[model samples]
Target: MENKNLVDDCLFCKIIRGEVPSYTVFENDDVKAFLDISQVNPGHTLMIPKKHITNLFDYTKEDVQRYLQYIPEIANAIKKAFPNVTGMNITTNNGKSANQVVMHSHIHFIPRFKGDGLKLMTRNNADQYDEAKYNEVADKIKAQF
Candidate 1:
């Protein structure tokens, strides 16, 4: 059953409704998995909830739990479908500052190989970090929680 509360102009919502074509991998009551059109790598896949959600912060506890519960299963299936996938990166960006182009929340499963030339992360100004700075940052975050 399609979600009736989908956003009118959300691209992912359109894909979910079959208004746009997608290489679907899996679908269940609350989520859907499909191949990413850009293919960050050959086996790059995107998983999203059936209900339209703007970002991680917008999800309720139950929504977060239900949406994420299918990740391990879908990730393992992707690994099996793609040969020589020694490692994988599962990532989701939140707001615009984080480079989240689509408003809808979605997780990307990117298959990795030895020397695939894809750098998931990079060190920046590591030597500039001091213990006091780290403690201050941690304290601020903990205060909010």
Candidate 2:
């Protein structure tokens, strides 16, 4: 099945087209999973849609369903493959400001162990928001739905 969303010059698109090599771990019609070259941890894997949608904001409901369905199975396989893994981080950055360097929408599955020293999402500003502030923000987001 040809991916209608393929972007000609995108690195991931090249990988998908076999124009570039990748350490591919999983692939189906709609998605591909591969080892991240910059392995933050030993088994860091990336899962990307075969479609070249740039980020979360670009995904349609059908795109989400098609691309996200493989996550759990892949995560479980990563955990099982690395016996020392005690937990994992499943995350995606939506834009350049959020550290999305590739521009192709992808999810990172980084296998974690104790003292892995990978500090993620450390800055917490929970105390800055009171109940009313929380409710106000929630209402604004809920309105979009």
Could you tell me which residue pairs clash in candidate 1? none
- Estimate the TM-score of every prediction: 0.93, 0.94
Q: Model 1 Cα displacement at 74 (Å)?
A: 0.9
lDDT tens digits, residue span 21-111, model 1? 9999999878989999899888799999999999899999999888999999998998998878989999999999988999999999999
Cα lDDT for residue 41, candidate 1: 87
Best by TM-score: 2
Taken over the whole model, the C-alpha lDDT of each candidate is 0.91, 0.93
Q: What's the true lDDT of residue 24 in model 2?
A: 94
For candidate 2, the per-residue lDDT at 65 reads: 90
**Best candidate per lDDT, number?**
2
List where candidate 2 sits over 4 angstroms from the true fold. none
lDDT of 2 by residue, 76-95 (tens): 99999999999999999999
